[model samples]
Target: MKLHLASAVSRLFSKILRLHYSFFSGKILSVRAICTDAENRIYLVRHSYTPGWHLPGGGVDNGVSVEEALAAELREEGNLQILGKPMLKYVYLNVEGSRREHIVLFTAQVSQPDGFSRNFEIIEGRFFSMAELPPDLDPACQRRIQEWVIGEFGAAAW
Candidate 1:
C-alpha cells in the first residue's frame, strides 16, 4: 500500500523514538550501493518518504547479513537485481541524524532496471549519467558519487 509521506515519516520516527526512550546502545547500519547499468549510468532513487535522490539502499535489519540487506533494498527501491557478487566499496560515518549511524557502500552491476515503477516507498527511480546528476541530490550522496564514482577521493576545498 502507498503511504503518504507524512504518515511514513511518522511511522519511522515513532519506531526510532521508541528505541530512543529505551535502554539502547546500538549502532545503526544502513546499506547504499552504486548500482550501474551496462551503459555505465548509475541508478538513483527519490523516496516518497524522504527528500533528494540517492543511491538505492536501506538500513540492514537484525538477522540479515549486510550483503542481503543491500540486495533486498536494491530490489525494493529500484527493481534491481545484482548481476554478480557485490564488491565492497566503502563504509561512511553518517553523522547527520545520529552519532550511531553508519552507511555501508557497495558497487554492483544490475539488471531489470526498466521495471522500476513508482511505488509506495519510492517516488521515482532511474539511471543517471554521471555528468548530469540532479540539482537536488543530497550533499552527502553527491559527495560519495564524486569520491567513489568519479574517482575524486581527496579533492577537498580547504
Candidate 2:
C-alpha cells in the first residue's frame, strides 16, 4: 500500500509539472526561409496539417541556437544550403491555442537543389512568383514577406 501511494504521488507530481510546462513554459522558436531565387520567386511549402502554403521551417529544438535550428530546418525540409545570415527575427503567439510564445522567422537564400523530398511534416514545396502566390498564406507570413520584399527593392508602398 505504501508503494502504491508513493507511485500515485509521483504520478500526480509529474502531471502537475507537465501542466505547468504546457501552460507556462511552452516555447516555440522557428526559422522561416524567405528563399528567393535568382528570378525573385519565393519558396513556400505546403504543410501536411493545413491547407494554405507556408514558409519552409519548423520548431527549434531545446538547447539549439536560432541559427543552428534554422540550418537544421532548412536541410531537413528543403535540402538546400542556407547562404548568409538570417534576415529577421520575429516573436508571435501561436494561433492554434498553444502556450507557445514565439516564432523566429529567419529569411534565408538557397541554391535550388537538383531534387528535394518533403518530409511527412510538409506535403510539397515550390517557388511562387510574387504576383502568383496564393491568397491564403498565413497572414503574419504574408505581411513579413511583403515588408521584406518592399524594403529590399525600395518599392513604394500604397
Candidate 3:
C-alpha cells in the first residue's frame, strides 16, 4: 500500500513537472548510470521523494557536462566512486507533451566497496543480479537495460 501510494504520487508529480515545463523555452536533460560492481551486480536506488527503483542519476546542471553531472549524482546519491570512464549506452527521449525531456544513459563500473547510506535524496540502494532485479523498477529503466543487453544501436528514442 505504501509503495502504491508513493508510485501514484510520483507519477502525479512527474505529470505536473511536464505540464509546468511545457511553457518553458528550453529542454530538460538528465543522465542515468547503470553502475555495476566487479561481481556484475547492478546498482539501483530508490529516491526519497520518488517511488520505484531507478538508475542512479539526476539532472545535468547548467554549464556542467553530462558526464560530470552523472559522476556528481553517483557520488551524492550512491556514494559511488567510479573506477574509470563511463561508457555511453542509450539516449532516450523521456516523455512527450509539455516537457521536451531527454535522458542519456551510461554504464559505469565502480571500483570501491559499497557502503551507501540514506541521504536526503536517496533513501535506499542495493546491488542485484540482472535476473534478480526488483519487480518495482521503473519500466523505462528496464527497457534501457534490455536495449543494452541486445546490443541494439540506433537513433535516440522519441
Candidate 4:
C-alpha cells in the first residue's frame, strides 16, 4: 500500500513537472474560495476539463486583484454571491506544480442564485454536506477543508 501511494505521488509530480514545462512559465497567481452557505454546506464545482470536484476558482489576471478574481470565479463557476467579506484563509505555494505558483484561498459565506445551470467550463456545481462529500473531491481542496473548517492544520504541500 505504501509503495503504491509513493508511486502515485511520483507520477503526480511527474505530470506536474510536464505541465509546468509545457504550459506554465514565470510566477502564477490563482484564487480559490471555500464557499459555505448558512447550512454550512460546502459548494464545489467540477470543471469540464478537470477530473475532480474542487473549489471554484481561476487564475488572477495580470491587473486584477485577488478578491476580484475570487468573486468572478465564484459567480461564474458556482453561481455564488458573496454574502460578506471573504476571509483570507491561506496562501499555498504550489511548488510541485510550479515553483513560483501561489494559490490564495479564502473563506466566505455565500448564497447561490435561484437557478444554476451547467456551462462550458463548469460541468456541475453543488453544495455537499460534510458527511456527503464527493469521492472524487480534489486532494488540495480536502486539505483546505481539513485545515480551515476542521482545524486540522498539518505540514502539507498544497
Candidate 5:
C-alpha cells in the first residue's frame, strides 16, 4: 500500500512539473501579413533574430487588439500600408514549445514599392511567389502561409 501511494505521488509531481514547464516558458502572440500584389507575389521578411524568411509580422504587444498588432507589425517591418481587413487567424505552436495564439494574417494590396531597410526587428524584406518561397522559413510560418494560400486560392490552383 505504501509503494502504491509513493507511485501516485510521483506521478502527480511529474504532471505538475510538465504543466509548469508549459506555462512559464513564455508565450508570444504574433501577427502576419499575407500581403499579395497584383502579380500574386507574397511579401516575406528575413528576420535577423531567426534564420529564416517569414511573413512581415512579429510579437503582438500587450493590451493591443489583434488588428492593431497586425497593423503595427506591418508598418514596422514592411514599411508598407495594409489596405484591407485580416483574412485569417492562426494559432501556431513552435518547436520550442512556445505558443503563438491568434497569429492574425492580413491580406492587402500595395501599390507603391516601399523601401525595406530592416528597422526595429526585421533584417531584410522581399516579395516572393508561392513557389519561390525561401527554404529556411520558420515551420509555423510556412504552415500558416500554405494554409492561407490554399484557402484564398484553391489548393488545386495554388
Candidate 6:
C-alpha cells in the first residue's frame, strides 16, 4: 500500500542522510516527544519504516536544538501544536545500532485532537489508554510509558 511505499522511501532517505553525515560527524542525536491530548491519552505513531509503534519523533537536524527538533517532529509526524515548554524526561544511549546514537525524550502537552492523516513518515497514529497500549509498541517506548505513567521502572537500560 501507500504506507509501505512511503516507509521504504523514508528508510532510504534516512540511510542516505546517515551516510552523508557519517563522514563528517561521529555521533547522532535525535529527539522524541511523548505528547498528551486534553483527555490525557498518550499519542503514538507507527513509522512507515519501523515495525512497531513509537513515540512521535525524528532525528535532530544539524544546527537544531533538541526543543526545536522536537517541535518540528511533533508538527511533521502528528500535526501537533506544542502549547508550552516540554519537560525533559530522559537521555537514552541507543545501542541498537553500530553508530553512536542518543535520544532526548521530552514530555509535551498538546492541544485537543485535530485528527491525523497518513503521511510519508507516519502511517497511522492514535491515542491510547495506559492499560491498553498496542502490543507492537517499541519496548523502549513501553518502558518510558511505564516509568512516567505508572511510576514503575524495572532497569536502567533503554
- Per-model TM-score, in order, reads 0.81, 0.71, 0.81, 0.80, 0.67, 0.85
After aligning candidate 3 to the native by TM-score, how far in Å is the CA of 115 from where it should be? 0.8
Q: Could you give candidate 1's per-residue lDDT for residues 61-140 as a string of tens digits?
A: 99999999999998898889999899887777776565677788888999863688776677789988988889999888
Please provide, for model 3 over 68-125, each residue's C-alpha lDDT reduced to its tens digit, 9 standing for 90 to 100: 9998999888788888899987677866433377888889998545598776557788
Cα-lDDT of candidate 1: 0.79
lDDT (10s digit) by residue, model 5, range 54-105? 7776667779987788777777777777665666544444444434233445
Q: Give the TM-score of candidate 1.
A: 0.81
Query: Candidate 2's residue-wise lDDT over 1-158, tens digit each?
Result: 75445555656765675577577774646566677776778888776555588887776778998788878877777676776766764555555445454666666767666657865555577888989998988766687688677764222211
Q: What C-alpha root-mean-square deviation, in Å, does candidate 1 show against the real structure?
A: 3.8
Question: Candidate 4 local accuracy as lDDT?
Answer: 0.82
Clashing pairs in 3: none
**What are the lDDT scores of the predictions, listed in order?**
0.79, 0.68, 0.80, 0.82, 0.65, 0.82
> What tens-digit string does per-residue lDDT give for candidate 4 at 1-158?
75445556656765776586547567788899888998999999976555799988888988899999999998899788999799887788885665677888889999986746777667689999999999999988888888876765443456
Clashing pairs in 5: none
Cα shift from native, residue 98, model 3 (Å): 3.8
RMSD of 3: 3.4
Supply candidate 2's per-residue lDDT for 61. Answer: 71
The better candidate by TM-score, 1 or 5, is: 1
For residue 122, give model 6's deviation from the true position in Å: 0.8
Q: Highest TM-score: which candidate? A: 6
